[model samples]
Target chain A: MIAITIQQGRLFDPANQLDVITDLHINHGRIIAIGEAPADFTASKVIDAKDMLVIPGLIDLSTRLGEPGLEHFTTIARETKAAVAGGITSLCAMPDTDPVNDTFAVTELIQRRARQAETAYVLPVGALTKGLKGEALSEMVAMHREGCVAFSQANQPVVNTQTLFNAFDYAATHKLLVMMRPIDAYLGKDGVAHRGAISSALGLPDIPSAAETLALARLLLLAEETGVRLHLSQISTARAVEMIHDAQARGLPVTADVAIHNLHLTEFDVADFASFMHVQPPLRSQRDRDALRAGVKAGVISAICSDHTPLMHDDKLLPFPESVPGISGLESLLPLLLALVREHILTLEQAIKAVTHQPASLLGINRGSLQVGAPADIAIVDLETDWLFNRRQLMSAGDNTPFHKWPFTGKVHTTLFQGRVVHQPKLA
Target chain B: MFGYPGLSSPSLQLNEAGKLKHLLTLEGLKPHHIQDILDRADGFINTDTRQIHKQPLLKGKTIVNLFFEASTRTRTTFEIAEKSLGADVINLNVATSATKKGESLLDTIYNLEAMQADMFVVRHAKSGAAHFFAHHVAPHVHVLNAGDGRHAHPTQALLDAYTIRHFKGADFSQLRVAIVGDILHSRVARSQIQVLNLLETEEIRLVGPKTLLPHDASAMGAHCFTDIEAGLKDVDVVITLRMQNERMSSARLPSEQEYFETYGITEERLKLAMPDAIVMHPGPINRGVEIASTVADGPQSVILDQVTFGIAVRMSVMAGIMQT
Candidate 1:
């Protein structure tokens, strides 16, 4: 393959602590050199990124591709294209799919589809328990060997504490990373939103913060005993963040990520009983949102993921409680993070690091860097470009985002996957 | 308008001209809109005493009682209201309906629509079931919520308001009304509070145990009190709510006797209110649980009168919405 050179862009590589205006040379799908290219290097293509900010491709810790079962809502090909448009180069696939991703065959199916799409790298997370029924442990060792990145039950906590302990023990012995989304199923009790004044007034059932913190406390204690590398997914409550902070302070091998929606939206957004705002660990109070932002700044929260679970079109058309949970978040991820930057909650460097190096490090991946010989995965972003995010213009079949028609200030100019332009806006 | 719940049923309940398309909730009903219903109900109250009890207003209209959640009192009252107005009423047992065969709620509504039903009287266990039907049903067909899960019971509220206006006069701003019993699980309590606020009542007090009271009662414009005596002090009306037996398992009440001792209205407790204070209950009353038998059957008891007013109030709402 011929070489490509990206010229005169402000490159920010958080993993190497490098931020400067530079040119990068890529050959054979690897970053060959930085700044001045070698004398023997010949550039077949050059991208003019003079006024753009180039950063390491974003890594999402949790995203639902809906390939095996829910392809009508979104297939791997459709969602990955949207992910690349949002500057995401890699995403961790959730295990909560049709038939569940508990077996090696199911994990392999996801990998095959992701390879066929060739947009973003997909790391399948195998179900912690068989069929995700929470009754018995799945073949974690075999699935891990099949290239499953992590083991998780997702939002479905194991049926009993003993089952969770057994799963933890098995995962510990296998030296595998287990992603736990802390929620006490009994406490959640079929609730669709946060239990507060909004829920009370709306006459809708609420899922209180206790649902998250209570389950998180038990999982952290078990992780401590089992000595498993535990990663908490989508921590939304302030109390949960504080507990994770304390666990990390006491030297537990623990890492936690907050979904981008939790940082920007709250329970008040669901006042109209808008089905699109119905997410698990339901959008919390404004106080919780503030604390989550603080957790990200304090480094207590190591990563920010999309938590992109897209639903069928009619699934969210029903009344509030009966509607499904989750949002189509891949396309809105970077715009929301830039909104955080615009609000001064995070600097541009911190925002980039949270989506790139922090998540990449948590997943133990080698791609979230711009060092020599690293994969040429990069995203060119225009910080000042304003755009309206209408769902009709988006690529995902789900089109179920709550932020449809919202005005956004940042836009992804181009995305590169292994030295190839996977997504770029067509000039008007 | 300030403390309105985030969910606006206005678009579903009101037509484009802002008329009552469906009797879903009393939340957004204007004072004039409520007064019109009360005034129209005044014309129906004396119909039984007349030679002919039938009216030609809704003569050929077909009303369907689509009760997904069973209610003997609400169903009977709505049926009587429809029959007295010379309309045909069909009561469908939803459990044995096509819904049992895994058909969706909308499919049931569509079947009813195909049958040319003019209105749907919906009593569902879900909070927004009535609103859901109202939004999706045929535009010409109206919907009336009998009671929905902890949401609203508009007819019950209308009847309660009529009873209060009958004895205490239409100038409700001078009256103090206390609604006592399980406020958390009672759809009646939520609806009553909305109508009471719309009537501009002074000092609406909600009396219940902490566990039985809603966390957002005060936000709905009521002074919440755990002490029944404090809530009843000098109130012009004392409204007691029926305590369903299932509340014990729901963990909202400790025991039947404990709830009776704490929040139940007694003859002596009635003395805490004004001398001529009228007691009310949305019936099928557990005699000794939510109120004493003496207080429920006494001269001050307007519980039976509420049943009498319920038919007239429902007639008023049905006629108002079904008007061509």
Candidate 2:
């Protein structure tokens, strides 16, 4: 393997409380040294990373790569390419694919496809229920053996509390991490937007804050009973954040993440009936958004994930209520995180940590750090570059994003996965 | 009505030159634009006979009635309005159309556009369906939202406004209007509230059970009332919306009998309003549920007049958009 040296870059790894100009030495798919290279280190390649920020590659808690099924929306190859381009070195693949990731075979297929894709690391989240029908528990232990990082029902809620209790109990017995997006099936029925003034004015079906809080309340109680390692996904409301905070304070072994879009967008963005702004656990009120940001700042909400759900153009062309909900979020992730820093919602270090160590720790992964001997998954970013997010520049197969034409101040210059240059923008 | 401010987005419903391009919502419309519609509707009516006159305003234009939801009254009124304006009208029932054959909405629109349809009078089960059509339709084509899910019914609001102006006077500032029943789900009530608020009515009162009323009712520029009698007190105009039977199944109401007893308009309840106050409803009315038969058939009831004025108001909107 060729040795590479990244010279004089501002290495900012929040996990190690690092921020300094340093020379990083990489060889054999791992970071060999930092600051001053060892005397024995020889470099075959040198990268002039002057005037750039080098940080641990992002570890997104949730991203949907439409492969193993629904390839027409997006493929693992295409989405992984998009993910790496946005500085995501690893992303947890949601379990709600066509055949779903409830079986060992499905997990193996995803791992194999991801290996061939050779971009970001794909961590498969096994479905908590068979077929994700919320009726019966799946082979959680077996799927875990197939290298499923965690188990989740994705957007599907286990409506029967007894079934949910059993699923959690079984997961606890195996010490499996269970991820859940809280949603009371009855309360959130047919809802496409936040239940508030905007929805009332636009007349889109509404999902109340109680829908999330109610489900979260139920899950927290069950997690307490089963002693399960619970990771809440897509926390959207202020009440949900408070509940999670209270649960964490009580040491219920809980962690949570908010989708990147939910932190920036709100229900008012859907006021014009822009179908692209439609997302599940819908963009809530401004106050709710502020509370979510505060939750991230306070470490109550530990991570900010892309929650990238790519869809065909036609999927978002329907009326607001009829349109499928989600944002094509992979490419927009880093720039938006930078935006939070610029807007004073989070500090630069805090923002980077949310996507890196916080998510990495939640997934129990060894990635998302810049320590010597760590796999060299790094993002070299030109933090001062100004650009507009255009659909034409999207790498993912899906162009269904509400962020098109949004002006961003930062851009990824290069990304190294496993000590190899996986993504580098061609110079103009 | 003149210079009612900040009601709806003119950009979505208007052309580049700020002319009416689509009648999606009455929320952002200028009061004079609404007056223009009411005035044009007046022009369609023969003052002596009080009957609509057929015009050739849209003689060469093809208007398609695209009903995604079943509607007899709205579709019929839009068809009558199109015919009165001398436009060729085609009715497409979505349930029985290519939509059922799995053709997408865009494909359906493209097919209709391929047939040289110039305008679409869209009634859909989903809110913003008309906006979706307006967004995707050819630039030359216009869209008129007959009704969309709990969103807006522009022409209905206009006709109700016309009905009010016909009985009460052009000065809406003196009028206190009460909109009763399921305000949360009624597109008619939503549009009526917007139009009445834009006209600068003295007060817009929304009367319904808390469950049937939008939580943000005050934000829409209206006062909410749980008691129908309190809401009707001294109101110059009373608009009753049909309570959907589905509301019962949805746990929004206990029963029809309870709703009638609590909020239903009766002869005795009618005494709460001004003596000469006009009563209106976007029919078909549930006589025993939302209103007493006596009140619906009463002398002050302009329920049937609303239907009559509806044809003229719709004709006015169609002519206004096409001519502009």
Candidate 3:
């Protein structure tokens, strides 16, 4: 492997509490040194990162690469490429694929495809139940051995409380992390948006905050009883954040993440019936969005994820309620985080940490840092450049972002994965 | 042109020139635009001759009645309006169409557009279905929303307004109108509120059980009252909404008998309003559930007039959009 030297960059690694202008040396796909190279070091290549911000590559907690099942909408290869372009070096691929990631074969298949793509690292979240039917248990312990990062139901709820309890108890016994997007299936049934004045006026079916708070209460209690390491995915409501805050304060092993979209958008975004704004655990109220931002600031919400579920153009061309939910979020993640910084919703360091270090810590990964021994997964960003987000710039197969045409500051100038230049867009 | 109060995107119902391209919702429509529609409806029905003269306003235009929901009354009124305007009409009950066979909505729309559909009277189960159709249809094609989930029924509101105009005069400033029952689920109430507000109706009271009312009922520009008698008191107009049997199963209400005992419109309750005050309903009324049979069939009831005016109101909307 060629030795690479990234010279004169402002490095920002929140995990290491390092923010300084320095040179980073990478040899044999690992960060060999920082500030100064060794006497014998001879760089095969050099990257001039002058007037740029170098940070650890983002680690997304939840991203759906629609391969092995819904590849027609998007593929693992396409999404990973898009993720890399967004400076996301590792993506925790969801388990809601065809032949659901309940088996070793499916888990292995996803990893193999991701490897072939040679982009971001794909961490498989094994399904909590067989076929994601929520009725029978899957081989969590066995799948964990096959490199499943954690187990999740991935939007499907285990309707039977006994089945859910047993699954939690089993996961706890095996010491596997269980990720749940808490929503009471009955309460949120047939709902397409948040229950609020806007949804009521628009006449869209509404999912109440009680659906999340009630379900979160159940999960918190189950996590307490079973002693399971619980991670709540896509916490949307203020009450849910309050519950998680209380849970963490009480010393129940629980962590939560809010999607990047929820931090910025609210139910008002869906008022025009723009199908792109239709997302599951649907874009909540402005108060809820503010609460989530506060949750991120207060550290009750430890990480922010893309919650990137890409769908075909036709999938979103229907009516709001009938349209498929989710945003093709990888490319928008960095810019939107930068937006928070610009708006003073979060400090730059806090924004970067939520994506990189915080998510990495939540997943128990050794990456998302620029320490000497760590893999050279880094993003060189031009913080001063402003660009309009458009479909022509979208690398993902799904052009389903609501942020299209939005003005965004901060652009990824270059991305390095394992010390190799994976994505370096030419200056326009 | 006034921007729609709650719509996040620019109203698709209007063109760049601010002309009526589609009649999707009344939320963004100006009072003059509404007055123009009501005025056009009056021209269709000659008061002196007591006849609804069929106009050739949409002589060669082809209108498609694309109903995804089952609504015999709404569809029939739209069909009559389309035919009355001398336009060829095709009724596509999508429940029995290619949609049931798994075809996408756009695919269905494209297929209809290919057949040269000039206008579509869309009644869909989903709230934004009409807007969805309006967005995807050909530039020349106009969309008229008959009803969508619990969103808006602009034509129904227009016809209801027309009925009120005929009996109570066009001046809505003095009208203390009471809209009783199911404000949460009634698309009619949503559109009625907007139309009433646009026409500057004084004191629009929403009377319903707390469970049947939207959480932000007051934000919808109406005084919400749980007490039906208090809501009906000295009101110039009473609009009773149907209490669906489905609400009973959904735990919204205990029983029909209990609902009738509390919120149901009766002759006794009718006395609380002005003696000559009119009663209206977007019917297929649940005879004894939301109203007593006597009140529904009484001289004060303009339930049948709403249906008659609905045809004219729809004809006016169809002609208005096509001419634009």
Put down candidate 3 lDDT per residue, B1-324, tens digits, no spaces: 124355735358888887899988888778889999999899888654446779988888999998888989888888888899999999988873556322377788888999999988899888988888888888998988889999989999999999999999999999999999999898999999989999999889999999898777655778899998899999999999988989999999999999999999999999999999999999999988999999999989989888888888888888889998
The best-first sequence of candidates by DockQ reads 3, 2, 1
- The DockQ values of the predictions, listed in order, are 0.35, 0.49, 0.58
- The C-alpha local distance difference test score for the whole of candidate 3 amounts to 0.89
Clashing pairs in 2: B7-B27, B7-B28, B8-B27, B8-B28
When summed lDDT is taken over every stretch of 10 residues in candidate 2 chain B, the lowest stretch is: B1-10
Error of 3 at A269 (Å): 0.5
Q: What proportion of the true contacts does each candidate reproduce?
A: 0.27, 0.45, 0.65
The whole-model lDDT of each prediction reads 0.86, 0.89, 0.89
lDDT of 2 by residue, A1-428 (tens): 78999999999999999999989999998999998888998999888889999999999989899977887666899999999999999989999998989899999999999999888899999999999999988999889999899999999999889999999999999999999999898996888888888777767778889999999999999999999999999999998989999999998889999999999988778878888989988999999999999999999999999999888877887888878888889999999999999999899988999999889988889999998999999999999999999977899888889999999999999999998898998889
Instruction: For model 2, report DockQ.
Output: 0.49
User: For model 2, what is the alpha-carbon lDDT of residue B76?
Assistant: 90
User: What value does the lDDT take at residue A336 in candidate 3?
Assistant: 95
Give a tens-digit lDDT track for model 1, residues A1-428. Answer: 66899999889898898889989999998899999999999999999888888888899999999879987556999889989999999999999989799999999999999999999889999999998889989999999999898999987888689989989998999899999999896885768778776666667777888989999999999999999899999999999889999999999989999999999999888866677888987998899999999999999998999999877756766666677788889999999999999999998878888999888888888888888898898999988898899988877777889899889997999999988899998989
